[model samples]
Target: MQITLIAIGKTDRAELEELISIYAKRLQHYIKFEFRIIPDIKNSKNLSEAQQKEKEGELILAQLQPTDTLILLDEKGKQYTSMDFADFLQKKMNSGIKNLVLVIGGPYGFSEAVYAECSGKISLSKMTFSHQMVRLFLVEQIYRGFTILRNEPYHHQ
Candidate 1:
């Protein structure tokens, strides 16, 4: 199955963008991967946290297909080890999912509506990282997961 990473806004930092692109390119060898960046909301400074999330949620929802399995990268979501994440991915593919969409929400997090629409959630770490950093981390983990599945030397026990 194909995998799509839906994140809000572009990566402003060149280093982070380059690193994200490196991992993303590496991932293409194993699976169909796409990183969908939703532009930041206009005049976001004037909006409340809830309102921003609501608008971002609308944009995020629009990128999804009816057959896609939506998974949010959330702070409160389940945290899996590299190997376990590979298994999670394997299970999804085995189940015959068409498109697996993983979302990284905006600064204030997701709205109640977005949460309700997701099939599952995954947390990369307990400590918080910048949204830009989260994009890189997620892509690297996906690459690592695939490497582990292939019994590559990239991941060590």
Candidate 2:
């Protein structure tokens, strides 16, 4: 199945972008993957938190296709071990999903509308992380998941 990672805003850090790119390239050996970045909203300084979330939610929802299975990366979501995450990926692939869309929302997190549209939510850790860093973490974990699935040396038990 194809996997798409959708994140709000751009990564300005050259180091983070380079590392994310490295894992993204490695992931291509396993399955179809796409990393989509939605440009930050204009005039966000004047918008309220709820207003910002609503606007961002619209952009996030617009990226979805009817066949896509949306999942959000949320702090309050389910947490899993590396091996368990690999199993989760295996199950999604086994279920024959056309596309697995994982989203990392803007700083304030997702709006209620966005939450309602998702199939599930996953948490990388209980502690909060910067939005840009989360992008790198997600891509790397996804690459690691595939390696674990294939019993590759990249992931050690």
Candidate 3:
């Protein structure tokens, strides 16, 4: 199955971008992985929190195909251990999912429409993280999950 990460805005910090790239490259060895960035909305300063989420949600939804299984990275979502996450991925592949789309929403979070469209949600941690930082974290975790699945030495229990 192809795994795609869709996030809002760019990673402006060079260090973070480099780290994300490193993990993303590692992930390519295991699956067809792509990181697509949805550019931040223009004139966002004038929009309300809900309005911003709505606009971003529209853009996020547009990137998805009808067959894509949408998973949102949300604070209130289910949390899984490293090994469990690997199994979760394995199940998706076993089920013959064509595309697994995971989204990291904008600062204010996802809109109602986006929530309705998603099949499920996942939480990396209970602690809050910057959206840019989460990108790197998510990519690294995905790489680690694959390593765990293959019984590689990259992930230590």
Candidate 4:
């Protein structure tokens, strides 16, 4: 199965982008992976929080295929260990899903519509990180999960 990570906005920090890029490249060795950055909404300063989420949700939904399984990176979602996350990916592959999309919403988070559209949600941690940092964290976790699945030395217990 192919894994796609879509995050709202760009990473301004070069360090964070470089790290995320490295993990993204490593992920390609395990499976088909795509890291997509959805451009931030223009003139968003004039919009309400709910309105911004709605606009971002539209863009996100447009990038998806009908067959794709959507997952949100949400704070309120379930938290899994590295091993469990590996198992989750394995099960998705075993189920023959064509694509698994993990989305990191904008600053205000996902809309009600987006929430309703997703198949599931996952939380990286209880604490919050910058949007740019979240991208790096998610990619590293994905790489670690794949390594754990293969019994590689990359991940430690």
Alpha-carbon TM-score of each model against the true structure: 0.98, 0.99, 0.99, 0.98
lDDT digits (tens) for residues 1-157 of candidate 2? 9999999999999999999999999999999999999999999999999999999999999999989999999999999899999999999999999999999999999999999999999999999999999999999999999999999998877
Write candidate 4's Cα lDDT for 72-148 as tens digits: 99999999999999999999999999999999999999999899999999999999999899899999999999999
Question: What tens digits encode model 1's per-residue C-alpha lDDT throughout 25-131?
Answer: 99999999999999999999999999999999999999988899999999999999999999999999899999999999999999888999999999999999999
- Backbone clashes in model 1, listed as residue pairs: none
- Model 4 stretches with alpha carbons more than 4 Å out: none
In every candidate, how many clashes are there? 0, 0, 0, 0
Task: After superposing candidate 3 on the true structure, give the runs of residues whose Cα lies further than 4 Å from its correct spot.
Answer: none
Stretches of model 2 off by over 4 angstroms after superposition: none
- Please give the lDDT score at residue 39 for candidate 1: 95
All models, RMSD in angstroms: 0.6, 0.5, 0.6, 0.7
- For residues 1-157, write the lDDT of model 3, one tens digit per residue: 9999999999999999999999999899999999999999999999999999999999999999999999999999999999999999999999999999999999999999999999999999999999999999899989999999999998898
Estimate candidate 2's alpha-carbon lDDT, on a 0 to 1 scale: 0.96
The local distance difference test score of model 3 is 0.96
Q: Residue 137, candidate 1: how far off, in angstroms? A: 0.6
| Span of 10 residues, lowest total lDDT, candidate 2 | 148-157
Name the lDDT value of residue 90 in candidate 4.
Answer: 91
